[model samples]
Target: MLPCPLPVFKGKNCRFDSCPSHESPPSSLLPSLLSELGVWTALLFSVESRLQKGQLLSLVPSQLAAFCCFSENQELKIMSGKPILHYFNGRGRMESVRWLLAAAGVEFEEKILKSAEDFENLVKGGNLMYQQVPMVEIDGLNLVQTRAILKYIAAKYNLYGKDLKEKALIDMYVEGMRDLNEMIMHYPLCYPGEEEKNLNFILERATERFFPVYEKALKSHGKNYLVGNQMSWADIQLFEAILMVEELKSDILSAFPKLQEFKARMSKLPSIQKFLKPGSQRKEMDPMGLEEVKKIFKVDEDLFLKHMS
Candidate 1:
């Protein structure tokens, strides 16, 4: 039998372990060889039997190259499979994306940009289509634009609704939720002196305008979800907006019974429950997070106020 040519590891300290040139093939290489041959069960047994009785299992140069390529491709597949979110470490535009993915039970990783250089690096890498943060790398595509990313994720995860009309409704409801979320997301960035004023504006709009829309939808639909009977992108966005508003005004839902009931029902979902846990991917907008955002984006209260106006 020809000896195995594959590199063998011995003791921890052995750096140059080698097998005899005439010894039987090692059992370690059997699985890879069997897998490459495309006959796992029967061929694995055959190879195992041969190895047990000291048989020859010679692999040619082409076979070795193919196996190496297969291993490399598998490694690449694993490394690129999980979605990577690139953004500042806070609840900005990326927060809705996070909420949608969590609701869909998809696991993802975050590349938190802590400095201007980090953002620049993303732009340099040509990953950000519009040279912006809140870019998500998923399914071998680097998705940018908050709405585009949200729509892609929603459609991919079967949360966009079942048909065109349902999708249109989901889109309409989501657009309203987006407006409400934008207000709450920027609330922390306002000047300290204007904080109360800005918060009051957000609360008034949320309670009087946004919350009532969702409240009536839930009430009229008489369904657990907003658009359709099942959970959709609109439902996810509504839940996220509700929580963000509640952060500013805990009693905001008291007057909206249907929305209050919707909140309770959505909260009990396993995925939503997981996201609401203390250590999940869900991020909170706070003083520290706000500072991080300002530092990373090089924005000040004036810039935020001007942009809002």
Candidate 2:
């Protein structure tokens, strides 16, 4: 039997392009054919497969290499090892941290936990979080809470700040964003119906408390990154925090024009933009939940929608 065609390309995992079966379209028909094809999932997968096969061919350990490459067990191992594990809630707090790790090109297994017990079992031993929404286990070490994980992963990936001052700045913004995110995530727990004497009392209290601090932080930093021009874990944390608030109660940001501009810049990031689109492994925010939160906060819903663009 003829083997599958090989396509050719290169990246961390998935090699379909290098398949031996891969063949160019007749030179004359290449451009028109490609234009008709648009994004080439099939061709790309083929290219990836061919590449993997080539790597297999290069294994020169004779008998052992031949057995491992030809056997089904090794292929199973390759498939299983492709993902790293991540534990999180669909809520923005954990989602933000999850997205950043992916943005940084980390491989992970994703575990979505809905209950408290799920969290407890997952934590090999708690280092930080009082709750379980976001946790990570890296090479036998388990970490709880979003910020702690972000800091360690960032430093490991060379995404953290360059110096002590920058790292300090990272901490400053992360703490601020964390405080705000906690309040926002917990908003529904204290919800009260409208016209029952006051509108969205719980949200009102949270907004009054958190937004002012966020505003001041923006003001203190002169509207750039918290520390320096380089992208730090802090920036990533802050960006995710703001997205939650924006998803929940957007008009809350109008009061802080600096933060609003920052939000705009953050949403445009190539990684973020692609992730927000349909079919990203990451999930999008709940539009109705956002609207409900806005109503609770008495924010300008129309203004918030304008920014979703």
Candidate 3:
């Protein structure tokens, strides 16, 4: 949208200097790395660069803001009559929140951030930058970060856990869901060198560490959902981890049959089913790199043998 002002730099080292520096890549991968670095810069520097390019980006509106701007201003800055959710089109992470809100019978608005500039505008607004997307702009205030937003909305809609103990348990699994979701969404973004290390780390921890935890948690609960008999944020988060994103191999779902069932069961929810409709994808500047990055997360192949060994 912004005419690619910050062109993606392939196969070259980034100037950020702040990001963890690796040894200079060989000649073959240099261009690719440079290009990927440009995208990395765009995402990482969006908030910082917002001011400099504010005017240019102002013309490029977010899906959420665009929807809001066209509509007449209501008495409430945001309307509870119809709940609104701001999401990036193809990035379906917010669908989990959509599912949660729908099941809770909340009516609201849904807005999507269509471009990098749209994201820039958001963070430029101070409070808008807190945790970034899956943001819930209540009334006029922007609530960033998914977990906190989810919890806040859940509580607002009375989806909170039954008791202190239940709340704690609900939170525990929800956090697990949160961590796993992040890992799945981002593991592929790491550079090739970083991928071998990071992917191996993720898989090992996922298998030896996190898997046992999930397996035990599911076994102990002995139920469909993560916490109690009812659905919670954990379900939304876990279901999303399996449902959304690009991958290296089969993803985290195939090995864990319980999680597979968890995903299948969640798919049956009307709200979640409705979310399957095509959403716009956040276009990547570093197209070549995005694929490679996505592949880092793909573990369907014998990654353990190749990288871990």
Candidate 4:
């Protein structure tokens, strides 16, 4: 009733006409105090109430601490919301991340690196980890390395599986899918006269190697998903890998009935349904042979070819 010791708030009929300004708590002390106080909601409400009244209260130590805590908490809330994907506009390593998030029914935002400077800026910000794209900002951390990001998201969303055995199976299946996906991801970067050759190689590998693995898994399991009774990371990766192959050859699944059925069944999932529709985060293969990608990343044909090799 003594008009509240903190002078920033003028709640209801209370006024702080004579309250002395207290020195702000030391920066190191703020965190401990905030944790000990455990009154974030009350402090925030008081600040909001003051703001609503258009009263510009002079900053006192308590008010400064409250403001700082509120700002940091707000930032964490935002980072914990939608994930922010950083990559070139074209689909590359980040595409799998997109697919997994989509299938998990998690919406995300993208910071497409349209120029070298845009990428440099991220590196300068010190959040790019190994200075790589496909870096994701989520849950108050800048996550790098594609597999790590995927594993975290999958585990967070309950798609990793129920136990160690299931997770191991999912990992096995996903590794194979990653192998196939890497092939498809680099196919477009093939040398000028080697598109046909690369295309044939991808088809050969998919039919002779990758497709059969998943086909056999689905058939052997006799379930709707690849690794378990429920959908897991493997299922989403397989679904995405199937689509990537289909883009190259529409009838690629003709030989694998199980894969065909798996494709159909996966397409019916609500999350996958949303992703399949036009204008979703799902990206089309670069129409200009990823010319934009080359320009943005500043990679010449020789470099791409070398990387592919």
Residue 201's lDDT within candidate 3 is 71
lDDT of 3 by residue, 1-309 (tens): 112222332223223333321222234643564365342221111321222211211211122221110011111121123445665553335655666776664555766555556656655766556434557766445676666677887777666777788889778777766676566555655566787787677666666666567667777778988777887766666565554331434575556777667777887887666655555222222324434422433333334112110
| Model 1: per-residue Cα lDDT over 1-309, one tens digit each | 222233332222211224422222356765674554551111222333332321223323221211111121121001224678987777778889999999998888999888877877778898777676678887558888889999999998899989999999999999988888877776766766999899899999998888888888888868899877899999888999888888787898889999888989999999999999999988877766666566666777566322111
Model 2 scores worst on lDDT over the 10 consecutive residues at: 62-71
The local distance difference test score of each candidate is: 0.71, 0.52, 0.52, 0.73
Model 4 per-residue lDDT tens digits across residues 1-309? 122234442223322245533333344544555465453322332422222322222232221222222221221111125788988776788889999999999889998887768877888999876766778877657898889999999998999999999999999999988988988987876778999999999999999998998888888868988877999999999999999999999999999999999999999999999999999988888858477666756778667532111
TM-score for all models, in order of appearance: 0.73, 0.55, 0.55, 0.76
Estimate, for each residue in 139-170, the C-alpha lDDT of model 2 and write its tens digit: 33556555666677787766778888777867
Worst 10 residues of 3 by lDDT: 67-76
Residue 50 in model 2: lDDT: 31
Among residues 3 or more apart in sequence or in different chains, the pairs in candidate 4 whose N, CA or C atoms overlap within 3 Å are 24-61
Q: Top lDDT: which candidate number?
A: 4
Query: Number of clashes in every candidate structure?
Result: 0, 31, 35, 1
Q: Tell me the alpha-carbon RMSD of every candidate.
A: 10.4, 13.8, 20.5, 8.8
lDDT of 1: 0.71
